[model samples]
Target: MSDNYAASFSINQPGRDAGILPVNQPGRDTSTSEQSHTEPSANGGSTVSTRENVRPGVSYLAGRLEFEPSIASKLDALITEFRDGKSTKGNTVFEAYDFVNSFPGGTPETRKFALSEFLSTIDSVEILADAARRCGDRAQIGLNHADTTATPRIEYTANAPNDNALIQAASQIGSKRARSEALSDADVGPGRENDMDYRSGEKRAKLTTADLPWHSEALAARQDGRVSCQATQDLLYRYERDPGWVRRQVIISGVAPPTIPPGEWDAIFRGTPVNLDAVFSSVHHVLPPKEDVGRVGSTEIRFSNPEPSKRIQTANDWTTAWDDVSEATAIAFPHRARELKEYGSYIRSEFSAKMPSSHRKIILYDIAIRNFVQGGQRHLLTDFHLFSRFHSAIVAPDGVVSGSGSGTKPGSSSRGRAGGRKIDGSKSEVCHRFNDVGRTCPFSTASCRYIHSCKGCGSTGHGQRDCVQSGRDSRSTS
Candidate 1:
């Protein structure tokens, strides 16, 4: 009859509980008389609890688990230490668990299938630490991951033509038959086809006439003289005593020098023969004197005794006979005929006695026939002889006038005989007939189109100094 349910049967009474219910304790007295039993809340409270099934945890089953039996048994012992290709110290704990299962959210699908299963397990770590230091003690402690075989195959062959036919029949039966009997007892030929006589003892001492003691005095001095200057100084002192014989007589007689005939200067000044008509009348008395003298016909001349002489005829004998006597004295002194034929080729080449008597020979034949007739044409004396001797230097009878030199006064002006007057104060007689024809400036007159539109900014026809649309609109509105 001790009925005090010590504050709700003290945790379902498992020990210090010797007595307790009696009010008809039948099924906890009919479940505490059907209803009311509330006294246990001082923070140690629980009424009938046992819940705990909340799963989705290890961070939600760590991305749906699987190959993690400790990283699939350290990737099956690092794919069996790379299929037994050795190196172990737990292969850096299987490469730090294969670089933390190659991250980006470790495995499942992210670590690109665990970095392609850890790069198909090895073929590197320096070839598995050089196959574990050359696989000492047959190293492979485990990793027959179901031995799927595949990697070891090598094999090569080829060099067999019966091992090069038994090394070419044992080098043709040993030491190549003693190097073919020491090259057939040293006659060593058969290969570069013979002929290396290397002067077979000086070409067998040049074959005859008592072995060459001057081959019978050079065959009796080539029968008297077609060659004798003492047999060409004993064949040029035996061709300079032989060795390479003056480069084989300068490669067989072609070294060059012999030409000779420019009229052989009369057989080179006749060391004794003279009289070819007394050497052409002593060189035609030192030459220059042949004036207008007549004939015009013959030319023969030849001589150094090869003959042909008799035809001198004369007038102007030929080779442009002093250019036909200076073109017939420049057609008969038409104004000192090219100063007397350039003073006859400068006194026939004694260069007019070395010039300066005010360079006379008629002033070097009037400056060598006025540089041989104004070299590029035009100057055959013009301006109607100073208007036929000055009719006030013929002012505008259609202008022209010219002359002023060799003894002046043909209408004055090379600045002399009180010359100055002409500028005809312009009534456009074409600017006073272009200043009486010495034309200084009617600027080619069709009234000089305002002097040809003022030649651009010396102002008129508008050359806005290279305008460019007034300089890009004055640089875009300044």
Candidate 2:
């Protein structure tokens, strides 16, 4: 503290130490002197001073320094005196800025920090503009300046304005006097405003669907069945074919059903009721024989013709055509499972009717497989090869085709039990003769001589309890 300010302020010369001049020191300029300095010459010949003009306490090399008290201390003294009514007027931002500029010899870094503090503490824009003109880097200093910088930095303090305070500020911005007043005085704290409360679009409230007058009319139309969901769906369908017509019917009229063409009315209403009889007939190709078809539950056998065109037909001619082609294909290729798309295409070609969707075809396939399994536990056919052969044999007028993948064709009575014998833990010389019939081992030399084989793939290397391939094979065999 022993003249640290003076020692810090003076630049290093040849011999003269930067001496401390105490406030009480007599015969020395202490009233904030500027312009020139009388110092003993470096060569000790006479008093020397800088030719370039130097401000009060600042010079090019040495920055401004504390005298008896620092600039901060002096500002604090002025503030306290003004608060106590000892000064002629209140401490204003202009006064604080003037006090800072008076000391023109301070370091650039020190001056910036001091100027930032003054700008932050003062609320007046005029004072801030003046400071910006005098400062070296106006943008840099302005960015760091904040009204709360004067407050002591501490832990866990809210430093932004809250929502209520911001609302109050926006409300008061209309008045000049209110704009001039401090945000803190307007009860605005120094914390951020919650974004949820500060939406920046048109200030008017948003309207919901229920707020529209037409909403009630639309609801009434629907409740009275004057506006059918089917009609709306038909409009969507027509949108794919004739978009302009659909737009006139739907968009122009606000989806009113009366806007639709008269030609489309009968089809829309007729398509609403599903033709379950035709659906059952198209899917019947996959069902078990007549006696075993009853085991399939009605709930498990759900089918729907997603295509609107098919649902419009009343003659059930499409089902009869599909049955003929499917039965013909089964008889000709008894060793192959029928392809859904191929069967669908043939029906469309012969009858010139649009086929059901792939989704509907898949549903039909699922129903067939499920019913085939539901016929009997021993009669389950999981292999595609066996399923095709068994289907062809059933539909074949002459007993020409059989359900065997190899020689020694099993008869119709034995065909159902063939799948059972494969999994029934019984051994036969024909099954054991090849030695590789059911062995799952990677090596071809591995043999299956045991009585028990896997219920899944008929493999003998692993039992059903430990087999991994068993479950996978069960899903795709038939």
TM-scores for every predicted model: 0.11, 0.16
Candidate 2 lDDT by residue in tens digits, 379-465: 222335445543344322232332221122254233212245533211221233222334344322212222334544556454444
**Candidate 2 ranges beyond 4 A from true positions:** 1-70, 77-91, 120-478
Top-lDDT structure, candidate number: 2
lDDT of each: 0.28, 0.33
Question: Against the true structure, candidate 2 has what lDDT?
Answer: 0.33
The best candidate in terms of TM-score = 2
- Name the runs in model 1 displaced over 4 angstroms: 1-67, 81-113, 129-478
> Model 1, 1-478: lDDT tens per residue?
0112111111112233434332222112122211112222234331211111222111111111223334434444554454443445346444744565453342232333333324433322222223232222111211121123324311111221222322332233223222211111122211212323321222122232335577666556545533212333333333333323343333355431112111222222221111222223323344432222233354334423433232121212211233433332232123435544544554344333432211122222333333433311122322223223332322223323322111223443332111232212111111222222132444433222112221112222222232243343222331
Model 2: lDDT of residue 321: 38
